[model samples]
Target: MAAPTAWIVAAAPLAAALSALAAAFVTGFDQRSAMPPDLAARFYGFFLDRYPLFAFAIPYGVARLLAVALAPGRSGALRRVIGAALGLGLLLGLSLHPTFGGMVLRAGFGTGSGAFLNGTPMAAAYAFGAAAAAGLFGSALGLGAALIGRPGTPRPGSRRRRAGRAILHALAGFLALWFAAALIGLAHDAGFGPWPRRPLDARDAAIAAGLLTAGALPHLLLVAARLRRATRAA
Candidate 1:
């Protein structure tokens, strides 16, 4: 890969890590007294364990590594497969817009965290449906971007073409981040029993969204780069 290409590859993980850190910062809250001790301990356990992994390591780091390995020289089929996964991740993220944004599970962005811990089936279904719908419009744009950015399709030298390709790559990375964020939700769902609640606010909500998006970017781009490399070779 050229210097520029290497930089492009390097940027995805950096962006993912930075976004996760920012989201973590925003979502940070001290509410030990707000909930039961056991429940609080469970929350902390997740925050310490799954939160870091899902937020930074698993989704972004692992997913990217997988993509690089899977999309080796001239592997269009594998690249396409990774692209599909990236798309699904993108859609998953779209659905969360309403959830933490005060549209789906909660009434508002900075409202109670109790809504997330509900063990009821109907609550889960309602939250799922709502988050899915919220992401609908954004998914269309993301899907379109994936199609437009099909690797090996764009030529190398034209400025306009390169710029357009760059934008598509950006969209792919963005959606990948969203996909990885599902882990953050899983962290909340851990220890499924209910407990006393407090305001979750926007910090955590954005972290939830961003971590998911960050995770998927590596897979999406690695596949694309592999496809492009293969195409050039052919």
Candidate 2:
């Protein structure tokens, strides 16, 4: 990969993270208040209910696809598998959009009497689903790009090879981050750890932010290690 292409590939994850962060703020969830289980469930449901899938998910998929297309790497049969998964994920994500059937489900099944079964549990499931969709979309894009674009030849001081490796490392970091976030949410819901309570005041917000950073550290370390390896190889 050329310097320009490497930078472009790196932008995908950055864009995704920024978009999600912005969405959180826009939804006024930057400082959530703690609630009982029932209320928590409804909150989760309504939160997902109003989410803008098009603003985030669709663009995320497109950016990842572009990243893969422009990245230099060797393609294989695995690319086909990844592409298929990407298609399926995108379809599911579209179906889960608020304006589609997801709205009905949220209103009918995610609130009121039906909410007991559909609220927090459904929200948790959706979180996992969204993460899976994002991962599959990104992997497919990267894999497809490697297949359709120039293949990197591994040799001494090969920039293309370095770029390809860097992309893989970045993808791994993204996956790690996603899984870590999901696990943190699950643990909080399960009452496993000292998760910050709602009404996230300054102290609570600081604690929550610190916990999130701690959770992400391992993934960041792995990314740093991979980059070091890539540099050494180059």
Candidate 3:
């Protein structure tokens, strides 16, 4: 069931790109109705701009490429591509939800642009927070590998187990912060948080929270399952 060709890699990424673009278009259409047409267009354009993509592309591309590259069989690549497309779409859609200090990671957070992730502690908190959420987006590609097979040769030794468990816990905690970031957006949408920040309407925050949360469920469950399995094997 091994993939012997290189084109599969290109195909998977091409499909995911198309899906992500399509998702952006769909969300942009919704934004038109959600806000004034001009603002919606500005945000939509920003969503796809090179700057934001620049922030996310390097790490995400490396992770996604690895997932497709490692997929076992012909069908395994296809199955993972299906998940890749969906994951890419969900990540793009979630990025549209405005929050604070999220930087270009989720542009339109504290300011209109990314502004990198340095400077103030608030900005760094958001940078780390968004990276955490993006961590799930990056790593979740591995979950698609599961469709190809089950866990193999449990890495032997307590050290490996501890490290794996630690990584999972960190990702889980980061994802929780991602959710907390969403809540912060929700609060602002409800007219409570920092003033003059980029605004996400109540509907915007609610919808984004629900959709991103649903998207995160698989990553969360994957972590829980791994933890449980590791515990049992110990």
Model with the higher TM-score, candidate 1 or 2: 2
82-163 per-residue lDDT for model 3 (tens digits) = 6566654444444434521122344334331234444546655555545544554444443433333322224357887768
lDDT for 192 in candidate 1 is: 20
The candidate that achieves the highest TM-score relative to the unseen native structure:
2
Q: Write the per-residue lDDT of candidate 1 for residues 1-234, one digit (tens) a residue.
A: 443544454455445555655554465434544667754554443233323333344234433333333332334665556665665455334423332221222221112233454554654543453344224423433463353234233456689877886677656654544444343445355332111133234554454445444544554465456455645644
RMSD of 1: 13.3
Give candidate 1 misplaced runs (Cα > 4 Å).
1-14, 17-181, 190-234
RMSD of each: 13.3, 10.9, 13.7
* Residues forming the 10-long window of minimal summed lDDT in candidate 2: 191-200
Which regions in candidate 3 have their CA more than 4 angstroms from the true location? Answer: 1-44, 47-50, 53-70, 73-85, 95-104, 107-126, 129-133, 139-234
Each candidate structure's TM-score, on Cα atoms with residue i matched to residue i, is 0.32, 0.37, 0.32
- Give the TM-score comparing model 1 with the true structure, all chains together: 0.32
Which structure among the candidates has the greatest lDDT?
2
| Clash pairs for candidate 2 | 1-160, 32-199, 33-198, 33-199, 34-198, 68-145
Over the stretch 12-117, how does candidate 2's per-residue lDDT look in tens digits?
Answer: 5436544554544445452255456664553344334333222234344454454454455655546634654555455444435543323322333234334335
lDDT of each: 0.43, 0.45, 0.41
Q: Which of the two, 1 or 2, has more lDDT?
A: 2
